[model samples]
Target: MAANGKSRNLESFVKQQLEGAQKRFGDLEQEAGKVFRTLKARSKGQAREVEKLLGQINSDALLENPKVKEFGRKATQVSTDLRKRLDGLQTKAVEAVGVASQAQVKELNRELSRLSKKLDQLLPASVKKVTSRGSRVSAS
Candidate 1:
């Protein structure tokens, strides 16, 4: 009789836990739905804005000028050539100094960050990568 009572209590406890979990999951589902709806609305608004911007862009008659286009093409080529020369100079500087340049350091840091995120996924959740710099944001 005692054993039966214990088994009955255990079964009731399990049922209660299951019900609680189901309720929590239902709440989570509702929250997720709300978030999805919010994001969907925001995305739709952005899409409309982008569409209007593109329409305005298409309506611009100045872009159709051949002379304007030729000038743009030449400007682009000059900029590209100048960029190549500058990059060559930068590389020569880095070689002469026998050290990584700021640009190189930033690129390496970015690659390290990407790899660290991937590595973190494979490792335990308790582990996190640390950053030396404080939070600093740059304008585009």
Candidate 2:
């Protein structure tokens, strides 16, 4: 009875450790997803703003203010260029901070997943066939 209880306690401890590890992995995955979403949303919002402004400049009503339209166009171009440069700088900054960008993280995760699947597929064949018989084991 004592041995059985000890075994059960050990099993539960192992189970708890596994659960904790799984939870941490899930949290990291979620954080990576959030980072990707944040980067994507910022870029998309900048693009949408530029597009909306450009569209307004092209509208028929804005023709009376040609100077205003020209300035708006210039502003849009400047904004687009600035956003690109800013994004580039931001990526470099993130690299400098020793944290992989969301894109790199995602790619690494994808490659890891692919390799894991491949490993799983090959694992069975890679394993040595252990014979229960002493004679067969001794022959190896």
Predicted structure with the largest TM-score when compared to the true one: 1
Which runs of model 2 end up more than 4 angstroms from their true locations? 1-63, 106-140
Worst lDDT 10-window in candidate 2: 131-140
User: Could you tell me the lDDT of residue 9 within candidate 2?
Assistant: 81
Residue 104 CA displacement from its true place in model 2, Å:
4.0
Can you write out model 2's per-residue Cα lDDT over 78-128, one digit (the tens) per residue?
999999997997667555545555797699679767865664565454242
- Give the lDDT of residue 53 in candidate 2: 89
The lDDT of each candidate is: 0.69, 0.69
- Each candidate's number of clashing pairs is 0, 0
User: How does model 1 score by TM-score?
Assistant: 0.37
* Cα RMSD (angstroms) for every candidate in the order listed: 24.1, 12.2
